[model samples]
Target: MDAALFAKSLLLGLAIAAPLGPIGALCINRTLERGILAGLAGGLGTALADGVYASLAAIGFAAFSDALARIDMPLRLLGGAFMLWLGVREMRPAPPRAPAPVRPRDLLGTTASTFLLTITNPMTILAFAALFAGLGLAATSSNADAALVVAGVFTGSMLWWCCLSGGVALARHRLPPAFARWVARLSGAILIAFGLAALLTALA
Candidate 1:
């Protein structure tokens, strides 16, 4: 694997994944409610999904990419709806009762949910396909090179998630319980707004 190519791929993957979309929002919420490790687990799940798509693109799976492009709108609509639902669920008033303790199982659940959510969005695959083609990366026939590209993608994604989760966690202590609750509400609202924007863009 060429070092320059690997670096380029890693940078591109990080740029694409750094956006604070629904998955990021969920990760942040989990980190705030549970801990940074839980959020990192969720981010790893997303990175795995991205690597899968990157592999598909690197292999020049034109049929698969074409199929994803064909159904892109519907997929975006579904994703947008799901994001909206998640935002609303997050924003709901917390009961006066004490919050439940974070469990190991909860980390696994968060990871699985984000992984499934990301995998179902075929647009991600198409985006990868286009990006690989544009960068002349689709012509890579060597398995080693392909593996390196995939690894780069995973590294880039993990870096973004780590930064995001860490940044959020750092601010966790500065705020009181009331402020934290308000932050949660604001985050939920921002997620909903992004969902609406995505839905509108798709419809348009």
Candidate 2:
């Protein structure tokens, strides 16, 4: 793998993952509710999902790609519905105390949930495919290069999650219960909006 190519991939991956979207919001919420480890696990899950999609794109599996494309809209609809449900759940009233402290099981659950959510988005795969094709990444023709690209993606994702979690944590104490509730509601609303937009695009 060329050093320049690896650096380029790393930068591009970071650029793509830095956006604060549904996943980022979820990571921040988890970090505040649980801890930094929980958020990191969630970020790792998303990064792994991205790597999987990238690998698939690098291999140029046409049949699988076409199948994913065919079902992308349905998948997007399902994702949107799930996000809406999550938003509604977040908007509900809660008790006046923090929930249980973070545990190993909590970490595992958080990681798995985020991983499943990220991986099930067929649009992500298509996005990776288009990016790989546009960047001529497949021309590298080396598993090591592919691995490096995956590492870059993982690093970039982790960086974003860490920054978000840290930033949220910094202000967590200052925010009262009421403020936290509003924050949750606002984040949930944004997530729902993104989901709706994605659904509309898929339908169109």
Candidate 3:
């Protein structure tokens, strides 16, 4: 086990996941509306997607990489559309209610939705490729090293999500319902803006 390699990968994952993008907003909203577990589930989905992208980048599979690149525009469009739908849904007014208990089905659906959202972003693969190359893990890493990198990335991403969700959950327990509602609306607006940006970029 290359401890240094693992450590670097872990930090890389944390850095990549730390940005509060649309995905982060979704997770935070879910945390406030559902619970910590639901938010963590969403994070797990994103972590898994990151792991998949990392593996694909590390393996240097030319065919797979090329295919992903070829479909980049379409993927972006789909992602943008999905984000818009989600944003509108989030912005919809809901009756004041207690946080729902996390059920297996709910977790599964949340995880699947987040995973799809993350995976659809074609730039994720490019980002992983660029980062791996920057870190000197591009051409020379062995199979074991690649595996470790994937594991480290997954673990690190999950760690960030866990911390974020926990903190938000604590606030959820204390904050008034109006605060949550306002936050949800803000998150939805952010998501809508991001979706518009993505769509325009794809079209351009």
Candidate 4:
């Protein structure tokens, strides 16, 4: 096993995911409002998306990359529409309710939503392509190494999510309901803006 390659890939995943983008904001908001399970589920979806692109790059799947690029505009539009809808829905003030056990459907929906967002972002694949090439991993890696690298990327990305959700869970108590509501509003607005930008870019 190429342990060094695995470690590098893992770190790369962590580094990529650590940035507080729209997805990060969503995860944090979910953690504060819905609980750790919701946040982790959302985060896992993003990890899977990252794994898909990283795997394609590491294994040099040029055909799939080209195909994705071909349909990028449509994908962006769909993702943007979904994001706008979600943002508007979330912008409403959350009603205070007792914390209940997480439902399977909720987790599934949350994960699927984030997955769609991540996969539709054209920049994600390009980022992986550039990173894999710069790290000399795109052309030189074997299938086995590629598989390992992909696995590492997923694991590392999930690890970051776990940490983020856990940390937020710990501080979940400190945030008052009013403050949480404000956070939700801000996060929702951010997501809406990002969605609008993506839509405009696609239309352009």
| Best of the candidates, lDDT | 3
lDDT tens digits, residue span 47-119, model 2: 7777776666555546546767787888888777767776676566354455356788878887887777677
User: Candidate 3 residues 1-204, lDDT tens each?
Assistant: 889888878876887778898789889888888889999999999999888877876677555568787988998899889888888988984665777788999999999999988887645656766676677656535899889888888888889999999999887867887877887888789778877877998999
- Give the residue spans of candidate 3 off by over 4 A: 61-65, 122-126
Best of the two (2, 4) by TM-score = 4
Tens digit of lDDT per residue, candidate 1, span 1-204? 489778867875786578776677777777777668877888988988888877876666675578677877777787667667767877874632223566878778887877876775544555666676777667777888888888888888888999988987788776566754665677678657756765886899
Model 4 C-alpha lDDT per residue in residues 42-157, reported as the tens digit of each score? 99999999898787777665765677779889977987887788789779857755456889999999899889888876556556666665665665447888888898889888
The per-prediction CA RMSD against the true structure, in angstroms, equals 3.0, 2.7, 1.8, 1.8
Give the clashing residue pairs of candidate 1, or none: none
The lowest-lDDT stretch of 10 consecutive residues in candidate 4 is 132-141
User: Model 2: which residue pairs collide?
Assistant: none
Model 1, CA-based lDDT: 0.73
* Residue 55 C-alpha lDDT in model 4: 74
Greater-lDDT candidate between 1 and 4: 4
Clashes of each: 0, 0, 0, 0
Better of 2 and 3 by TM-score: 3
User: Which pairs clash inside model 3?
Assistant: none
